[model samples]
Target: MNRSAEMADLSGTIEVARVVLVIGLVFLHYFAYPNSRVPPFEGFDPNHHQVATFVNSFVLFFFFSAVPLLSTISGWLFFGFSARPWEAIRRRIGKRGWSLFVPLVIWNLGALAIAFALRAVAPTSSLLGPFGIDFAHFGLWDGVDAVLGLTRLPVAFQFWFVRDLFVTVLASPLLWLMLRHAPLLAAAALCVAWLADFTFFGLFIRTDVLFFFYLGALARLRGVEPRVGWNTTKLLLLVYVVLMALRALAPLAFDPSQPDQREMLDLFTRLARPLGVVACWGLCLRLAATAWGEVIGRYGGFAFFLHAAHFPLIIFVKFVLWRLVPAETDAWMIAHYAAS
Candidate 1:
């Protein structure tokens, strides 16, 4: 293929992968928010519940790659292809300010308003109570606290991703410099930094974002591509399966509540997440020219729109489902997933 064709193919592959990753993220949220009555096997026997949790958590591990993959793709496309890094940064800031930052602020305020209204109208309703705020008890300080993410209550639960992405973009110039000067050394340093106990500016900077972004930049600088064949893809799959099985299943069989085991599992998952990103990318590349790829690429932009709007939609759907069902039944779960 010609250079332009090759680049388009790669872009299509990444877009398809992104669509899949976002769908996985939706599933992760569906299972994570038990209060939303969306978890498929929630409220079962203790053993059954643990098993279900394990399975859900395992699925989540595969999709944890979603954010990293996004950062990597962004870095690759933004810094990798840029002729002038500083000019690119200025353009990125303007674009992202309008696209990401404005939406974030607007959505969070909207979510807060919705929650406040729900709390006011349905103070005693179970369906609305979880999402509602205690307006009667809510002080100005409480409002500020929620805005700052200091409490369990969030203005918008998924805004963290936007916040982190904003931070990463703001730092991209420095990152691009590092990647350009010494790609391998930069990647190695990032990986080590990812494994370390650290925070930036008193907030926990997502090291995975930095790591994967630099990884992508380094890949572009080094002219790397997803060149895995079936055999290599199978090997990656096997490794992922084994590690996830140990991470997920072992906890169910043992005392998952133990601090040490939980810590160990967290560490294991951190190591496995990047491998999962690579495996998923390889799979996407392998299928990028297939009929399915066209469909995925067609909806890739919609995935971002969905991510932005889905949380409020979920809450609204839950309210509607509660009114229709009036009971916590399997139908609620079915309807919730369908809406999601």
Candidate 2:
């Protein structure tokens, strides 16, 4: 096929894959992520009530789907990662982005300022009064915290992704060199490291994550336009499904009676996550090469932002609506109205 035809085909397939992924993600969050949609502990042990859990899951299925759609549009309008200050800084600083002195100085000041501000206005609110004014407690301050943590410092939950991204970016130079000399070996190393990451290391061991992105870049650099047939796509999809199944089963492999087996299963699941991510990503890329690729790519690009921002927006809207409206009506309805 000619270059334009190839590009269009890839774009279409990517779009379709992205749509499927978004749907699947919402499904997982609603049914799989219990803590997210379910009510917080009404009592001490936080026991899940059968009725509440059932209602929460039913409502969340629709709610999670809407967030991704909204977040995808927002990120596309805002300039992808252009909202990230450190991403800009990295472009300017290049490899020296990791140099501790100047970057650390800047980050510390930012954190301190946030801490002070959180403390200052915190007393008015029950939540913040005890924590003292800090980025950890404040809504506006958390985004800044995410940015600063992207500089490879650990600040909080969102910072983990940022830090992982940074670690990947910083190691790109060495990865580039390795790719030139030994592409096969480089890919193998990445797979192993990815497995290691699941079982042993924290997210900061970014070499594995960077490996796949670099692999994609290298394929482009090498003029490789993979023409994956339907059979191949099917095979990949099957493998992905099995991997996901195994991941779910991994935790259950151990009987509650067998702690040793449980630990092993837990370890296995950890390695399986990155592997599953790769398998899923591969299926996504293959599907993206088809007609619906463009749509998928657009939505997939905003997955991170939408994933993070939507929770807060959903929470805030739910809270406000609950206060204003009677409990007799649906909380999800109010959340939906506010979200819209």
Candidate 3:
């Protein structure tokens, strides 16, 4: 294919990937944990509620790659098929300011407003009560922090992805240089930091994300387009299933330190992330090739909105669900997942 055709094809793949990734976000924020409640996340026994237990396991195990894959996609798009290095990076940064930063600020303020309102209306509101925030005593500084992610994660925590992406864009020059010259040395250093989940300047910048972004840059540097064809799909499916099974079944037999017969099902979580990225990307590529590709890519216009807004929407959805059901039953949990 010619350069223009290739770029167009990759763009469609990325749009499809963004849509799929946002759907994963729903599975993420809206997850109905086995014993999750005020503090969220607790016991796990597939026996207790087979569907709820394993479905959540699917969310936990498979969806962990959403962010890493997203970072890779973002970095790839930034450098895709560009010959003018400085000009391309500058243009990418400028466009990101509009596409990412603008929406980030708007959504951050919107979330902060909703959280503050919920807190003020009812100090013990489900919104902030469980987090032990005496929203009744929330101050101007707290408001500032919530909006800007100063002291902690921003009120719209998911937007941290956007924030981090923007940061990476600003630093892409350095990352590109590192990836181009001393590729092995740079990747090794990033590997240590990624494994540790290092945060930069207390900004909630995940190094794993940076490392994945680096991988994407490396792909561009090597003129490699990440594609999984029909030939590889079967093997990918086999490995994905095995990982899924390991995630779901391994926890049932082993006991965690909780001592309540609760098994930590995420033993293979970190191990499966890279695979998850590959699988999800493969799905994106395959989906982007079909007749439905253009249809879904059209909704890419609202993908950012859906992603940022869903965090608060899920909160509202859960509150209404709690009011309707007992919140403990397997039926209730399934419904919660469905509504979310």
Candidate 4:
């Protein structure tokens, strides 16, 4: 194939991978509702409940890589196409402001407005939490906190990715320059930052965004591409199995509340996510050589729309379920999972 055709094939493969990743994210969000802890499913048969818990844990273990993979792909595309760094950064910021920032603000406002309406209509419903616009309790500072993602009241919790993406894109030019000039040092600095945040502050700084974004830029600079053959694919599959095992055993190995344990898990996650991304990318690249891959690529852009709109739909479904079934009940949980 010609150079243009090759690039087009790569783009299509990435898009197909993105679509699959987003679907996995939807499933992750669905199953991870209430909390990351697997529910006991009380009153059910012990064997069946144990099986369900194990399945849930297994699924969530691998699903953790989706966001990192998305971030890396975004970085790759952003830097790969840019001829002039500053001009590209300026263009990207403007585009993302309209496409990302504006949507985030609108969504947050819309969610708050809907919550207020719900509270007004059904005063007894347990829907509204800190999101309710009670001037007496919720002040301007609280609104600021909500907008900044310190509080998940006004904004959909899923939009944290949007916020992080905006920040990463805004800083992409500088990161790109650093990677070009002193790649190793830049990577080391990012790793230190990530470690500090994960160890000390519990990831309040969101260095995962920076780490994966820069990793993508570095991959582009190094001309990295997926070249998985049968043997390599089998090796990667083994790596994936080992990663899943570690993820499943995490809770049993250490208390999540411990800083050291949290740090260890975070480090393990950093390793596992990129490995998963590579494995998924290789598979997508192989698929992209087929006819159906083109069809999948055509619909891949819908993933962004799905990400933006699914949270509201989830909330609506949960509200309907809440009205029908008691909270914390097995029926309500099942309905929420299905709706998601």
Candidate 5:
């Protein structure tokens, strides 16, 4: 097929993938491990809550790649067919701003505002502690960091994805030039840095964003579609599941919160994510053929809204539900997940 045709097909596929990934993000946030140490989270006694353990393991693994996948889509769309990095940058930043820094600040500030209210209503609530909303010694620096995400992540924290994404977007012009001059080498270096968990304080909070974003641009530069043969798809899906299963079951042998075990789990995560990203494309195609895909597609434009709004909403909803129900049954968990 021609390059234009490939672009068109990938574009359509990406649209569907975006909607599905947003839904996956919500699922990832609302439905997660129950750590009793964390006020907003619950913990299960492995001896008793076998079912909850299994669910958390499977669900967390399945939905872990949303950010990378979404980042890739953004990169691919930004470059487009002709590769106009400056133009795309202008569009995103030149205006009042759409998806990058502007939204990051706005959404994070909104979250801070809600936290302020929560703090006023329940100064001594333990739930407020987890969110850094205890209002203890709160000062100008704290407020600034919480709103601007200057040194640390904002109160919402999930905007950390956008923070990293914006950093890469701003660097895209140089990235495009490098990719144009040496696509394979550039992509390889970025991939290596990402897999190594390379980090710098000033920029690129997550190296995966840099890798996946450039991966998308690389795909466009080479006219590669966002798919693989069924055989390759099966292989990726297998690898992804195996890695996730390893991650889920590791707690059986090791204390996951300990430094050494946490590093091991982080290693597993880095290895599994790329595999999951491709696996998700295959899953996307499957969903696209069904009614569920159509329903998800209808929510495509709301991806930004959902990503921005889900954090504080989940906190409030989860807190209230926990208070009202006072039970952590499987049915209640499912209901909470559905309600959020």
Candidate 6:
């Protein structure tokens, strides 16, 4: 086939791959591990329930692994066909406008308002005793602490992809230049950066940041679509199965009052995490080749927003439902948890 025909085939294949990645992400978040444990009281206790663990193990893996893979690859394929980086981004931002930032601000404010309200009413469940800020803990710096407290908001963390994506969109032009010149090198650097953020700096460095996402975009942009052959896919699937088994067996290990569970997961997630992401993505891509795949492809643009909005949306809806039912035995909680 001619070069033009080959490029067209490549683009079509990438579109399919992108759809699969997006679907995999949605499944990982809602289906794979929904009620992730969050350590209560803030310590390294192994028995704590952790929200971060669920987000990282299920939601984050899909977001970081799949979305970047899809967006970057799709962007790259389109770029190869003559779309300019700035022009594409301009079009994207123009369509979305300032609507995207609304979620970030709303999530932040919502988290704070809820926390204070909870503290005033529920006290114990709302804030940890020794670790929490109380009347005694209050001082001139109380206000400053309050603002910083927003960073710890669990609901806000759910929409982290929004802040991260904003960074990616902003940096697209520079990322495009780098991808055009050196794609493999860019991917390698990003992998190193991710490892450093996860293992070394821990939560201080957010992998969801645009620079990391941009790296995935660069890989896809540079046309580095490695077709994982059937054998590779099978091997990856086997590894994923083992990891999920481990996950099921690994009971809630970290307490919120101690070491972050994310650190614990990051340490072990090293071996099987990437493998699972690749396998899941590969399977989705294959599935996307059918009529259903075409339907999924149409929703690709909305995936990021949906992923980011799920957490806040969940909380907002739950609060409304709580007002109606006003009981711990409310049936809505069951349905809400089951749905998202």
The models' CA-based lDDT, in order, is: 0.67, 0.43, 0.72, 0.67, 0.71, 0.50
Error of 6 at 317 (Å): 6.9
Q: By lDDT, who's the top model here? A: 3
Q: Each model's TM-score?
A: 0.82, 0.52, 0.87, 0.81, 0.87, 0.57
Q: After TM-score superposition, what is the CA distance of residue 3 in candidate 6 from its true location, in Å?
A: 9.9
Q: Give the 10-residue window scoring lowest on summed lDDT in candidate 6.
A: 36-45
lDDT of 1 by residue, 203-298 (tens): 433567767877877777777865567678778978987777666565445454577765666677788888887777778887777998888888
Candidate 1 TM-score to native: 0.82
Model 2 local distance difference test score: 0.43
lDDT digits (tens) for residues 123-238 of candidate 2: 45432322223444556455554445532343322223334444555555565567669877877877676554452244353443354555554555465644545566577556
Candidate 4 ranges with C-alpha deviation above 4 Å: 31-48, 123-126, 129-136, 148-154, 198-205, 252-263, 318-339
Enumerate clash totals for all models, in the order shown.
Answer: 0, 22, 0, 0, 1, 23
Return the lDDT, model 4, position 60: 66
Task: Tell me model 3's lDDT, rounded to 2 decimals.
Answer: 0.72
Candidate 4: Cα lDDT at 196: 57
After TM-score superposition, what is the CA distance of residue 49 in candidate 4 from its true location, in Å? 1.8
Residue 315, model 4, lDDT: 58
- The 10-residue segment of model 3 with minimum total lDDT is 34-43
Residue-level lDDT for 203 in candidate 4:
24
Please give, for residues 125-170, the per-residue lDDT of candidate 6 as tens digits: 5133312345546554553433333233233454444555554555
Off by over 4 Å in 3: 33-43, 129-137, 201-203, 254-267, 325-332
Clashing pairs in 1: none
Please provide, for model 4 over 1-340, each residue's C-alpha lDDT reduced to its tens digit, 9 standing for 90 to 100: 8889888777888889878788777666554445224432111122333333444555566767788778888777777664677787788778978887787777776765676577779766645543445534767776665565654433565677877777677777778679879998988888787655542243233666678778887888788864566567667867896777656656655555577776777677666766787777677777777898888888888988777666656656655655555565445555556654
The residue ranges of model 1 lying beyond 4 angstroms of the native Cα positions read: 32-46, 49-54, 124-154, 315-340
